[model samples]
Target: MKRRKFLKNSSLSTAGIFSASLLASCETDKKPQVVNKMIKPIVIATWDVLNATNKAWQVLNNAGTALDAVEQGVMIEEADINNQSVGKGGRPDRDGNVTLDACIMDKDSNCGAVLYLKNIVHPISVARKVMEETPHVMLAGKGAELFAYQKGFKKENLLTEKSKAEWLEWKKTSKYQPVINIENHDTIGMLAIDSKGDIAGACTTSGMAYKIGGRVGDSPIIGAGLFVDNEVGGATATGVGEEVVRTVGSFLIVELMRQGKTPQEACEEGVKRIISKNNEKLDFQIGFIAINKKGETGGYCIQPGFTYRVYSEQGHINKTASSYISS
Candidate 1:
């Protein structure tokens, strides 16, 4: 009888221990799960266009969408009468016409563009409307103007008195030489990542000074002047748009990021591609700026004097030089 009682007690204790262990395991599993915290917003642009960057930062600061932030940011530059490479006071073409080109892209791969568009003060806004309202990816010339007018955008002369005077001066010389960043800044390419981590980009320009009428450069082309892939990153180009178009530079940088390269590495690769393809060496400069999904930024250029502006939580506004400048 004593031996049987001891065996029964041991079995009960064993059962109780196993039940306690199971209960503890269940409680642990029921604990709340943790989610990843969102990173702060970032704004980056091709030039030290701090005014535009600050405008973009306001959108991001207010928790606005990335697409809206990029559009609003570049629009500031587009409206600045002092800025000769973009917006209202931009340089005229060889025919004394103020034609504009612009493109916008979102994380969902939706993009829109307008090329050779005339008499529109804000081409970036028109590009956004095209992306949101139309099925087609691009509209050009009078068609773009019609669309802009239909969409309630005012039709006004884009050329300013200062621009006209400069055009007259150029006519006297008839020289086509373009000094980088002075006469040939080409475009303002802006990229932004909102608080929600969504990415978008915009590129707007009056194209090359003295370019032939109806000339469209990389600024209006999605993969060339601007590209955005939310999962990977975004990139934009400036300087010589033709060189950028030939290499599909912005798209190449995004792909490089997807392939695990850093933003700097990707931008450098874009510059190298341009160099390799133009074996005869380019007479003009070409530059690329990129921002990764993590909000890290980088830039590279074929010639010296290329710079970019970056804004992030860690830094307010940083003016950084490109990685490479040809000798």
Candidate 2:
């Protein structure tokens, strides 16, 4: 009988030990998995565009949102009186009016844009307000200006003395022919991914130099000049806006990425699409830059001399050539 009792007691003790060990193991397994915390943020912009990357990097480093970073970054170029392609100092239309076009997009698919908006100094900011405060996707011309005024944006003449002088010179001959990257570099498109992995993009321009009055380009049109999808990536365009608009270049890049192509491949495909569809080979430049959710970046252009700037923890102010540059 004592032996039987001893056997039973030992069995209970062993079972209890096993149960305790099992419980401890289960608790250990249930502990949350630690994710790598060293993922860096990314910023990319079309062309060098002055110190725009620095401005964007500052925002991302300070934990600001991606939307804020892109807007702040491109605004530097917009306000730069020397950059004839964008913002206040941008080249004017044939009518000598410096009209602006801009668009902003966020990961949530919210987007806003303004086209042929005159007198406003920062059309990008106006675009942001349109995205956030209004139900419409776009505002144009006088209506856009009125919205800017209501939003407390001051009206300022966008044309600088230098830009005006250039316009007057162009009027001497009234030559409408524009060289690639000289008179037709139409936008400063910026894309950024914040520390939290959210993506956003912005594209702003003064429209094509010496374009007819009231002409709008792809810069203010979502999916053409800019597109952002947090689940995939973001893309933006520069150069001839008409080709980009027809191909929906930026949107095509993101969708290509969704199909598992790398950023470079997607961008090249975008450029190729334009080549295939156009009746004649493009004589002007058209370029695209894209960044995936993984922070990979790539760009491609129809003509040579196209470059883009990137900022990240790995390095700041890195400039890279496009994968394909037309001969």
Candidate 3:
């Protein structure tokens, strides 16, 4: 009886030890869940693009990804005939061609762009396809249009009657200059952070009024017109494309944010960089808008009267950005 009792106790102890060891092993194998501590999802864009921001807010409010939000948001402006700087009604190049340039960057560093693409009203969508469907980052001119066609994009004349009439009148002077006034703002660049904390950006424009036919601006260039680091944040440039491209403006603001600058500070530094490079009269304008990883936003411009629109859980409003020239 004593031996049997001792054996029973030994078995129970062994079982208990085994259970404890198994529990320890399970505990060691389990990983802590990585929940994203998301701030309020926000959408920001250059100029008074409230409609576009609200469209983006619609996506974010529905838990859509940042990439989708930016794409859908900008498509509104692209289809709007009154917004001549962006899509269907954009002014023509010197040869009376209505060319569009656009670029999109998503969280994983994936990007796509189309430069000098004609006849496609929604170049932002085309850029997204170039990101997802193709191995190339950019397609240009006729090649871009062909790619759009192959991808089932409808080909329609992008030049509206109003734009064509304006182009015809512009031919009288044949004088070429980049216009900086609000009515003639050049690029519609947008950035967003989603509910999952992912970042994305898109920039689109018709090149400056009466620009050379073959000229491409910062709009379709990834680091120049728009840049998103995902882990850091995103930045975009509006106004003069050449100066922005020369300094890789958008990328610079993002890097500055990574190095601990607030979005506002980074944008101010960006405008300063452009100023440092140009000694000539600052007749042209440049605006840099930045959003950091925390959803903090800022905008700085080379000239006064620049504006930006913001939409978030807090609210939606249009605010004038402080300028290097004056406010």
The prediction achieving the highest TM-score against the true structure is 3
Instruction: Give the TM-score (vs. native) of candidate 3.
Output: 0.87
Give the per-residue lDDT digits (tens) of candidate 3, residues 1-327.
Answer: 699999999999999999999999999999998756867799999999989999999999999999999999999999999999999999888788999999999999999999999999999999999999999999999999999999999988988899999988877765556444444655789999999899999999987877777889899999999999988999999988889999999999999999999999999999999888987358788999999989999999988899999999988989899988532
Better of 1 and 3 by TM-score: 3
TM-score of each: 0.86, 0.86, 0.87
- The stretch of ten residues in a row with the least summed lDDT in candidate 1 is 177-186
What's the residue-level lDDT of 21 in candidate 1?
97
lDDT score, candidate 2, position 159: 86
Model 1, position 239, has a per-residue lDDT of 82
Query: Which residue pairs in model 1 clash with each other?
Result: none
Ranking by lDDT: 3, 2, 1
User: What is the C-alpha local distance difference test score of each model?
Assistant: 0.87, 0.88, 0.91
The backbone clash count of each candidate, in order, is 0, 0, 0
Counting only residues 3 or more apart in sequence or on different chains, how many pairs clash (N, Cα, C under 3 Å) in candidate 1?
Answer: 0
Better of 1 and 2 by lDDT: 2
